[model samples]
Target: MTASTANDQRFREFKMPDVGEGLTEAEILKWYVQPGDTVTDGQVVCEVETAKAAVELPIPYDGVVHELNFGEGVTVDVGTVIISVDTDPGAGPVAPAAAPAAEAPAAPAAPEEDEEPQGRQAVLVGYGAAPSSTKRRPRRQQPGVPAQPAALQAELNGHAAPAAAPAPAAPVAAPAPAPASVASAPAAGRPLAKPPVRKLAKDLGIDLATVAPTGPEGIITREDVYAAAAPAPAPAVAVPAAVAPAPVPAVVSADRERRVPVKGVRKATAQAMVASAFTAPHVTEFITVDVTRTMKLVQELKQDPDMAGLRVNPLLLVAKAFLIAIRRHPDVNAAWDEANQEIVYKDYINLGIAAATPRGLIVPNIKDAGTKTLPQLATELAELVSTAREGKTSPAAMSGGTVTITNVGVFGVDTGTPILVCRRVLLRHPW
Candidate 1:
């Protein structure tokens, strides 16, 4: 190979690293940089979806992009080179025959064929070193259709490319005022925006027609919708005039067989539930009690100056009651270790509270909750609920729970068979 070709071979290839713990593979959802685009180190090149969550992969070298090994929607194994970058962009391509074979040993090879130099170990930090072997799944296509490029195939398959790189939301723009002649006129055309953006605008009570478009090709953007909702002066002044009220949309009947993909937190919850149901021999008991005095105390707590601005709801009392009950019957918090043929008793109470979020149900617990005073428990409980609702609960927050509490009364649910979290005792409260 010629010296120029040898220089080009110095291009760095970035592999699909393991983004999550024990993740074996990920589906390329979208590509932010196509071949020939200039890329910088630490720039997010693409987004991938694993079993647990969606994560973005960043390029690690500064260079001109050479090629993308696979197209969008392709499920790539960990350690497979996904993109190549030519470090020397100014160098021109040389004829392969013109180069001396002995001098051009590093000329080039397809990413799949490329191997690490002997004696030098290359590691991608948190991802470890690329695997010695790599494999790509065969492309799926119509019987007669010819093979297409990665991007084109991705479009045809409709595999999460659009959501890969969510367009940066623009400020919500208000709908521009209409001319006097068309003040009461129906919209001349449909507003331009992605379905998600439109849904957000609808939820925020922002009229699309009134929102100004700042996106490319006069598209309405999320930022535009948010800007309209802002108290600041809007770029477009929406005309407030009497117009026919929009007709209510009829609700469609539910499908008999509604299929929901089990993944992420939902999948984890399902697996845990199944394991707990079969592995643990549960003996449940129920007691009805008058909570009239409890409700009076909640009211009294709200009136107390010290409790002002803090959450003092029925759940708080329920949590405290469980803690007191556990304190009296410490043996209930023990776990049965079948493998060891022993019952493991706990010294501390890491009380977990079940919370429902938009994504799925999660149980984030308060650490050493049994040691905390009532006020401290209330504070921790409030924070845990808030974090769970926002989907920001960390794995650490959800681990090491000695027991769990699920408040069915919050949903007007009288009671529920609370599943154990990791073979631990779980309590259900109705009031």
Candidate 2:
């Protein structure tokens, strides 16, 4: 349903733009607009989570949305057309065929058919559809038929298939008597177990009729299947004179280990670390200073009316000290531009504070930290920590950092070699 150049000249395809530094793709996390929805220039149509951060993409031109090319959770490549917007507002009702049939549902007839096209039937994506409850139709089991193929049975059993044997002359053995605790299964009725419990019972080779149900309304549960599969304890009269051995832990073997695709923040962090490690010549320098007075100052500031309701910690003083050092030696606050063969001396300090969140190590900087007072800096630091923790730190917060200060002390490390964050001078502090 994506707008093709051959389809209509008025239908402009909006390509997925790179929202971060050299990010090649992003996962469409959520869509805010749908087909036939009226959108204006600069209106946010969708939110995409890239390798670096989550960004809301805005449509550049005012138009009626035609179709979205990809579904949510789809990692679309940069420069790929994700959505098509029809510039003509007077265009007729978007044909159900215009959108993917799987996504757009048929509209019910009503007096206001004109209104239905705009509000109901025109949604061209599954994400926009209202939730519908579904029930599974009962599968009838056939007699004298194996549930699985013979090849699959051999593979699951971990053995080669044997040659077919002659039919038994008589009944081999009588069926085991139904236990008093076990309930009898209803005639021609499916087992009263949930899908997961049924799967567990199948894997354990336990029959539902052999398991006594403890769950409400005679429904078989996972615990019931496990109890039925478990070996019964020996009676005192049946036991040998020797002591009973302890139960051994079962060993589990898997055919294959689960593999999670490396993408998003984790992937970006890996690439950045590798590039920085190879390209930047890292120099490690350690300095031990007496922070006895600094600790006392932080305590004093906490009680001060100026620092009321602000996070007054040793990190605040440490950040301020780094800023003063940068001011003392202004030349170090510069970057070597390899492409231009020039040193770019920056006048302002965009201090980067390294934060470890659930996503990855993100260095969101305080813009113009040098211009802020102690209270202002503390406030900014508190906000930055909160934003990073919520995974809502913007790309702008991570960009334009001239110097980075990583407090490894928070991680209980005394000292560590911090990787250069994209050519910036890194300062690591271990408590």
Compared with the true structure, what per-residue lDDT tens digits does model 2 show for residues 1-431? 44443346677889999887776899898999988799999999999888777778899988888889999989999999999998876755443334445766678555442233334455565446432332224455444433565566666555577666655555445455544344554444565899999999999999887777888767888889999999899765755647868779775555456677877777888999998889889999887888899989988998999999999988899889889888999888888687887888899999988889887888889999889899899999999999989888888887889888888877677788888886665554635
Cα-based TM-score, every candidate: 0.49, 0.57
By summed lDDT, which 10 consecutive residues of candidate 1 come out lowest? 178-187
| Model 1 regions more than 4 Å off | 1-258
> What would the C-alpha RMSD of candidate 1 be, to one decimal place?
29.1
Candidate 1 local lDDT, residue 138? 61
In Å, residue 196's CA in model 1 sits off its true spot by 74
By lDDT, the best candidate is 2
Measured by TM-score, how close is model 2 to the native structure? 0.57
Task: Assess the local accuracy of residue 76 in candidate 2 as a C-alpha lDDT between 0 and 100.
Answer: 93
In terms of lDDT, the poorest run of 10 residues in model 2 is 129-138
Question: What does candidate 1's lDDT look like per residue over 188-298, in tens digits?
Answer: 677778999999999999999998888876788999999998887658866556675677987766844577766666777788789988988776778888989999999
